[model samples]
Target chain A: GAGVSQSPSNKVTEKGKDVELRCDPISGHTALYWYRQRLGQGLEFLIYFQGNSAPDKSGLPSDRFSAERTGESVSTLTIQRTQQEDSAVYLCASSSSMNTGELFFGEGSRLTVL
Target chain B: AQSVTQLDSQVPVFEEAPVELRCNYSSSVSVYLFWYVQYPNQGLQLLLKYLSGSTLVKGINGFEAEFNKSQTSFHLRKPSVHISDTAEYFCAVMLTGGGNKLTFGTGTQLKVEL
Candidate 1:
């Protein structure tokens, strides 16, 4: 793909229901990251995956939030028992090299937990 | 650990007026600085970055930022502005030699008025 792509641009789910957001990074990108942006707030780092190394989960808000990436392609961010506070724009980004420091981002998945 | 700080929550500027958004970062080691812009209902786009070169860095939309190691600042500036420049701006830092995790600031909203 020409750029990073994200699925389910907008989602509204009842509280406690599970929701999944998908991200397909740019081809050949070796680094992938997930972030959450609440209304009028800065992006909050959720997770990071570089190559086949162990993902950096230090930024996940809680245990209920989990993300997985297969190889360096598609990734899924699952929020278990979604809560109202989980409503936000979930963004995915990729970089050709982890050290590049410049990220290409997706349009983002707007999640609304009703 | 690395952290970024956007001093102003919102900045209102008139069309054709010059604008500057302050950003400060804290890190114990050498770091790379970046500025990203987000238009309404859109994803983030890289504006510019400072990566171990001259202190001044230029980016798209006539935006520029200077890396001030002494002050730990990477403030964004533009000599003239247009309504299309209205967007939310983010400051991020990535420590060199560290894992591929980016620490982001809370963001500053730039509202360009006529």
Candidate 2:
């Protein structure tokens, strides 16, 4: 792909419903990340994947938030029993390598919990 | 631990005028600083970064920033502004020897008017 791609650009769901956000990173990129941006809030790191090593999940806010990545490619973030406070923009980004300082980001998926 | 702070939440300036967005970061070790711009309805795009060598770093769209180690700041500046430059700016820091996750500031909204 020319750039990072995210699916379901906008999502609306009732509270307690589970939502899945998908991210397809740039071709051949070796690193992928997930972040959340609440309204008027800073970008919050969620998880990171580098090659086949263990992902950095320390940033996950709660047990309800979980993410999975397939190698260095597609990544999915799932929020179970979503809360109204979970309404925010979910962003995905990728870099060529872990050491690279710059990142390429997706348009982001806006989740609106009702 | 590493953190970034964008001093101003919003800045409005007339077109052709110069503008500066202040940013300060706290880190205990070597770090990389970066500025990212997010246009309305779009993903974040890298503006510039200071990794190593030369404190002044230039980036696309005529944006530049200087890394000041003494004050632990990486403020963004532009000699001239345009209406098209209106966007949300984020300052971020990544520890060179730690995980690849970036810590981002709350962001500054730059509004350029005529």
Candidate 3:
């Protein structure tokens, strides 16, 4: 794709249900990132991946929240036992490399856990 | 650890008037600065970035920002704002070589009105 792409632009689920958000980074980009944005709030870093380096899980809020990226391609963020507080927009971004400061972003997936 | 701060939650400016959105960051090591804009129902796009060269950086839509190391601030400015300029602006910081994790601020809502 010309830019980062995300699936399930909007998702609505009941509390305690599980949800998965997908992100497909720009082709050939070696770095990918996931972030969460609450209503009217700033973005919160969730995870990051660069090449073959160990994925950064430091930003994951809890064990219920886990993400996996296959090589330099598609990535999935799964929220298990979702809570109402999990309601927010999940954004995905990709950069050419870890050294590059500019990031291309996806439209984002909005999750509403009721 | 690095963090960003956006003091103004919202800034209302009249059309064609000048506007400024303040951003501050704290980091133990050298860092890169960036500004991103999010339009309604859209994804975030990079406005500008400061790496190593000049302190003044110009971005799209006639927007610019200055990186002030002394004050740890990267303030976004526009000489004249249009109604289309109304959007949410975010400031972010990335570690030069630490882990490539980008930390973002709460964001500033710029409301350009008539």
Q: Which candidate is the best by DockQ?
A: 2
Kindly report which residue stretches of model 2 are placed more than 4 angstroms away from their true locations once superposed: none
Off by over 4 Å in 3: none
DockQ of each: 0.79, 0.88, 0.80
- For residues A1-114, write the lDDT of model 3, one tens digit per residue: 598999999999999999999999999999999999999789999999999999998989999999999999999999999999999999999988644678889999999999
lDDT of 1 by residue, B1-114 (tens): 888999999999999999999999998888989999999877898898888879999999999999999998999999999999999999999888877677889999999999
Residue clash pairs of candidate 1? none
Q: Taking chain A of candidate 2, what TM-score results?
A: 0.96
Tell me the tens digit of each residue's lDDT in model 1 across A37-93: 998788899999999999999989999999999998999999999999999999999
**Interface RMSD of every predicted model, in angstroms:** 1.1, 0.7, 1.0
Candidate 3 docking: what grade? high
TM-score of each: 0.96, 0.98, 0.97
Instruction: Quickly count the clashes in candidate 3.
Output: 0
Q: Could you give the DockQ of candidate 2?
A: 0.88
TM-score computed on alpha carbons, candidate 2: 0.98
